[model samples]
Target: MIKAVHGDITKLQGVSYICNAANGIGPMGGGVAAAIRKAGGKEIETEAIKVCKEQNPMPGDLYVTHAGTLPFQGIIHLVTMKQPAGPTSYDVVRTCLHNLVAYCRKQGIDKVALPALGTGVGNLDKAKVAAIFKEVLEPVKDIEFIVADIDQDFIALFA
Candidate 1:
């Protein structure tokens, strides 16, 4: 099941993994990623950097890391761009969603909190990103996805 919510994704309850619209280089410095780091702790970023060193994940790849102080199983860093603050495209977002669903199915992740992908520093339009999410994820039947954002326009797309 999927639903839209207006709030901070970092503060969402019952979700073990919250999707971070991350850059490939690994730094949770801005936007929702920053908020999550602040709440979860610097350890989360440290783990992310370690993963980057090991795998150097590209756009559309889902990198899993420890949640630090946050009360959850893990954090899913959705690499949307190659570097921090770089732009991302709709196609990348689609690939990320597709990979996320596959990863969730393979890893048994049932619930997730996801924010608007590539709408921040990536500069993609919220509605278009939302459409891509719906296109790639609407067919998914097992995962309980919460498409969350503070922006009403983004949430309205899911509604």
Candidate 2:
């Protein structure tokens, strides 16, 4: 089941993990990433950077790290752009969603919360990206997704 919720992603309950639309090199400088870093803790960013150092992630890759001070099992970083503040296309967003599903299935993760991919610094259309999320995730089985946003308008499209 995929549900849309209006609020801060960090405040979501009953979810063991949340998704972060991140860049190839992890910084968590602005937008949703920054919010997660602030609420969760700076160590979240440090852990992501440590993972990047091992193998710099490209778009469509999924990396998991400790949730720091957040109340979750882990944070799933979905690489949406090659660099911080770089542009991302609908194709890349689609690819990331597909990869996320694959990773979740492979790892047996059942529930996750995610924000609108590529709509912030990546500048992709929110509605379009939301549609892509529905297109990819609606068909998957045994997974629960919460598409969270601060904007009510963005969350409404998921209705």
Candidate 3:
């Protein structure tokens, strides 16, 4: 079942993994990445950098790493933008969700906590972003997808 809730993603429960809205280079600089790094520890950023060096993820790509001290088993860093200041496209968001779902299936992760991709710093429209997620993930079975945020506007989209 796919559900939307108002809460902190870092403190999410019963999810196998959580996603970070990251850049292509994988620095946990600000916004969602910063929050995850602050809660999960610096090691999360370090491991993400290692994966970034190896994979050199581009926009619309994804890299996975251990969740560090966070409760979840893994952190799926979704690269929604190449640069922090760059504008995000709908295709980029769609691709990121697509890659995330594929990775979850491969890792046998049955549940995931996802933030509003590109909405924090990228300043994308919340409803549009939410719709994109619904489009990409609605058909996938078995995986419990949770679109989490503290913002009422964001949570209302899922409702």
Candidate 4:
């Protein structure tokens, strides 16, 4: 079953992959990207760039790359925003998660990890964000979802 948890993104146990809230260019930006880079190293950045080049992912599009140095088996980086740079919104969050599920299904994966998609730099409202996720995800029963919100209030919304 899909579950919500509050924890460090770097230390998620058992899940094979995590979603990176990346930009169109696909570099490791701040927040979750920074934390993943700190644990996984720059090779992750290089691999993401390679995939980003081929995909040119816009908001809601999904890109896949090997985890590089991440402890996880692979990374499914979602471009949650357009190039100008900044916090993502509810639209970005909702679409990114859909893209993520599609990619996960393609790869024969049933369980995955995610950070709160547009909340950090995106500055999206927590209640709205949680509601959007629950709405989109409440119906997809093919796979199990695990999203980690860095903040506590978001966790309550999901709980």
Taking the tens digit of each residue's C-alpha lDDT, what string does model 1 give over 78-115? 99998999878899999999999989999999999899
- List TM-scores for all candidates, in order: 0.97, 0.97, 0.95, 0.91
Which RMSD does model 2 reach against the true structure?
0.9
Overlapping backbone residue pairs in candidate 1 total 0
Q: Write the per-residue lDDT of candidate 3 for residues 1-159, one digit (tens) a residue.
A: 679989889998888789899888778988888999999999999988888888999999998889988988888889998776567788899999989888888888988988898888788888899889988899888788998887879889887
RMSD of each: 0.9, 0.9, 1.2, 1.6
Clash counts for all predictions: 0, 0, 0, 3
Q: Distance from true position, residue 68, model 4, in Å?
A: 2.4
Clashing pairs in 1: none
**Candidate 2 TM-score, C-alpha based:** 0.97
The sequence of per-residue lDDT tens digits that candidate 2 reaches over residues 27-96 is 9998889999999999999999999988889998878889989999999999999789998899999998
Error of 4 at 156 (Å): 1.6
**Model 1 C-alpha RMSD to native:** 0.9
Q: 99 in model 1: Cα distance from truth in Å?
A: 0.5
The 0-to-1 C-alpha lDDT of every candidate, in the order given, reads 0.89, 0.90, 0.87, 0.79
Give the winner by lDDT: 2 or 4.
Answer: 2
